[model samples]
Target chain A: MTEKEIQVREKQEVQQAGEPTKPERYFVPPVDIYETDEDVTVLADMPGVAKDGVEVRLEDDTLTIKGTKGGNGGEGERVLLREFESGHYLRRFTIAEIIDQAKIEATMVDGVLTLKLPKVEPAKPRKIVVQGG
Target chain B: MAIIRFTDRPLFRNPWADFERMRREFDALFQGLTGEYPRQVGGTVYPALNISEDADHLYVRAEIPGVKAADLDISVEGDTLTISGERATGPAEQRFSYHRREIECGRFSRAITLPTRVNPDQVGAGFVNGVLTIILPKAETAKPRKIEIKTQ
Candidate 1:
């Protein structure tokens, strides 16, 4: 069997119109979103970000995920070759109303964050017999 | 009296900014000199590397999320360091419809040439938060030595 090579992607700098307050550069983390029968799952890759540095917020149908990474390399050490830059991770998605906001859960492991948003169950159909008045 | 000597190059340096300009020149010069082209002018290489050096050791780091330590393989042969690993996701039991699939999971390997010779026996590595850091001690022959001045 032939082995597949994972393609390399440079971190993309986040650019939002009319939002100039953020001075430090933030990168758009690559994510995978999937939906099963019960809930939707989101997996984002944010390396070098510890558990305390990650924050997930959901408000007004918008879900935002942020991760901050500290500076790398030691003092007095000179860089020889650099192929990537360390920065904060930011991404936002518009969540549907069918999701159950109270049951959303998030967990991070080895710099990858996994979020689960459970869908609201639809009301079951009921049969009713009306008594003669 | 102790004599203090300063190097010619400035201490505060940013090499990445210069590398971008130098890469373009080297690409153009190589194409002009030889009809065959090397790698792409501006393209992403797999498993991006950040190499840094101090007086004693050289550090190499790579960001590889969702890769387990058991799946990774690292080797140092002479002046070449090879990093290979596989990123495995959840099992294929539950089939779910994907809305947006950007993260790719597969096997990848990259070999880097060290700028200076290193002692392969004394190399060390660690993985934390999906980032792999490797420390290689410089060989004795490659380290700088100061000569003593003798007056008769």
Candidate 2:
């Protein structure tokens, strides 16, 4: 079979799985990506998500975020005017080679997710010394 | 008059009648003191607020843990500032039968009056770590100026 035929077969299998043919729904939080001298910082807004509920994983070259938000329950008649429904959130990003995967650190505070991705040693700046004869 | 004659008199009277009347009266008094009645008795609670000040600016930080940037509305009129937002609740039909809920959710609005005049054009707002930081810079005239000292 040709390469195109193999690609078509894979697409058919994915469609049959009853899953979204396109990428998963992006729970793109309002993320601020900033870089300092030592590392790059990623600040993500993941409200109602506890520290224990958040899951950050890196596989191959992809980084993924997954979490669940618990519902609110009370023993009274509720007249809800507006609702912000929460569900399992998933987001993945393809990482670049400049990232030092081993040195990555993640912390969750007040439902915000902060990831610090340090650049590789070779990617960091270094000063050269001059010698006068 | 319609009941001019005593037809039948009960041998015993309901003693709890007086107690029930007292309970109702107490409830009414409590409601009156609170302004709004029962329906408004229990609602969403507001989070704690922290404010800091420096020579250049005043920083107001609110602990709004579950609100998103898109859901938030911030407005400043003169010296009055308001921040309002709604938090995301979980999915429909995904109900929790019994669980301890500590985090606050629902619509919240907070207003603050500034101590000094602020430069509205230079005001900055940022949300990080589930805390909203609003920076209000002092007006040029309100800011402290360094006076030149002449050697006599």
Candidate 3:
């Protein structure tokens, strides 16, 4: 998939990392979070961000999702109207359960980011069976 | 006399831009006393766009997240161009209930009249990252013609 494609290109841009002189506009991407039988799923709309432009990080109990979308609008194109602002996507959420961080998986399709965070099995309720009395 | 006015506009204008303007005025004039709840008029909820034109083509770019080319329908009739599409809500088989919901999802439609005639067949569109771009080339006859000077 294109997911790996982004990682390969990411290697080239690593040396140039850090804050730039001009600060960019950062906006929160809308998200829908749900908890299933064994996992929690997060779906966020982060249009314009490519696979390489997205970042998901977990530290302590906080989970952060960041995405950057590069736009090369045809030069000299005058804007006749404006509706939405184009910028970076940044969002953070605190986890309530002990999540299996190693088991987390994320995918970017079109402009949507689908994240699966599996809960630690030990955290789920388990029933013990009694032998013959 | 034609006078140009400028101000902050809503997110999206309805198909009828003229009426959307009128509705905004009415919404302001009537204030909040009406029986129904007051709401901003003709504002787009997600992915705003911009339209621009040069001599050859009209350029349009919309910031739509997760919009697939197949999920969109674009057409041009007369001077108006329309774009409509749906944003999929992701896998439908999640058995768990939604803990929190904030992103808006549904079919969206918007149409705008161009400033000049364009050749529909020559139009080109591209979707990158999540932005949708459309280049509508001007019609052959509509393009300005330059007359060459004759030598003395």
TM-scores of chain B, in order: 0.69, 0.63, 0.62
lDDT of 3 by residue, B1-152 (tens): 86645545556756786885687568645644542223333434333456777778888877666668899888998779888887665567457788888666666777788888899988899987677999999988878789999999
lDDT accuracy of residue A73 in candidate 1: 51
Q: What does candidate 2's lDDT look like per residue over A38-122, in tens digits?
A: 6766655565566777888878777777654444222132222111222345556676647788899998866767788887767
State each model's CA lDDT, in order. 0.83, 0.57, 0.72
Which scores greater on lDDT, model 1 or model 2? 1
Worst 10 residues of 1 chain A by lDDT: A16-25
lDDT of candidate 1 over B64-152, digit per residue (tens): 89998889999999999999989885647368988888888888988978999999999999988888999999999988888999999
Q: What share of the true interface contacts does each candidate keep?
A: 0.82, 0.08, 0.62
Task: Write the residue-wise lDDT of candidate 1 on A61-83 in tens digits.
Answer: 89999998876655577767767
In model 1, the runs with Cα more than 4 Å from the true position are: A17-23, B1-43
| TM-score list, all predictions | 0.81, 0.39, 0.70
lDDT of 2 at B33: 64
Task: Give the chain B TM-score achieved by candidate 1.
Answer: 0.69
Best by TM-score: 1
Residue pairs with colliding backbones in model 3 are: A47-B65, A48-B130, A84-B48, B11-B44, B12-B44
Q: First chain TM-score in every candidate? A: 0.89, 0.63, 0.75
